[model samples]
Target: MKTALPKLEPGYHQRYIIPMMRIGKNGNKLKVFKIRTMYPFSEYLQEYVVGMNGYNTKGKPNNDFRLTPLGRFIRKYWIDELPQVYNLLRGELALVGVRPLSEARFKELPIDIRERRIHYKPGCIPPYVALLMPDSKGNIEAERIYLSEKEKYPHWTDIKYFFKAIFNVLSGKILSS
Candidate 1:
């Protein structure tokens, strides 16, 4: 993402710490890195994602406008996440699993739902049916449908897409986002 986002938005530039990270698989705070999508030292960093301040705090969509020409592109196609390959190389994530969420969101999750993710590692994509959330109308409902079939999450529902998505990434089939 650091190498690419600039081509999309010229003025955008930023760095990030993604603070108060949650622990790792071995029970230590995890802090993987990625390229920035906001302006340099953005003021928004001080602002939380969902404002719960306890769990899931890391998932905030701050509505920042610091995107550079390239930054926009990276985010559009989620290319900014490429650097996480280093994390995977180091075993910070799995090829397929539940998406890591803000601490606030994680803490806020219902016990059953939260525990559902405990069996797997965080990863590049979520097991979610993202298409439903595209219109911004069905995140909860989609989650409900997914929850009813909890045994099929990130594994059954996600593995196929994960492979397909990886292939698309390798093949350059989905870009310019």
Candidate 2:
């Protein structure tokens, strides 16, 4: 992987890439920046990030032989997730908060969690990921673990997340590292 950041040329079609979700009851657009994971599905104008292993998801294998060589490299060190920091800089996301879901997945979300997940600006990274950093199972578990703490999460604020994020990073843990 290159040491340099690959900056998207200005006017990159973000809405086409990251996804803009509408909660339906109200008009809103929450920003997210993600690398192209799956080929775009015309029906949803989105792509899916295949989980590394079956663990706890329904997507086809991430290590499927079909992945382009670039895909494999991107997935290896999580370089694919780096673009989201731009989303953070733009204020569509916070440094810490629940991970954003795509409109397709968002629509499938139970109303309450969807409502809560969208309440705070979604984040470039989330907290419970500390313990959940192994693989998709850990990602799933992190979210489950977070569900109990979700309500208080908002009041928990940015500063708290920053410290915890530091702890997790220093310890070399991540929900999907």
TM-score per candidate, in order? 0.56, 0.58
Candidate 2: give the clashing pairs: 133-174, 133-175
- Model 2 gets an lDDT of 0.53
Q: Best-fitting candidate, measured by TM-score?
A: 2
Worst 10 residues of 1 by lDDT: 129-138
lDDT of 2 by residue, 1-24 (tens): 645534545655434345434332
Candidate 1 residue lDDT tens string, 41-141: 44334334324232221133434444567777777777677776777788887765555554544666566656655555666554343322322223334
Candidate 1 TM-score versus the reference: 0.56
Please list the residue runs of candidate 2 whose C-alpha ends up more than 4 Å from where it truly belongs after superposition: 1-27, 37-66, 133-150, 153-160, 175-177
Measured over all alpha carbons after superposition, the RMSD of each candidate to the real structure, in angstroms, is: 9.3, 8.6
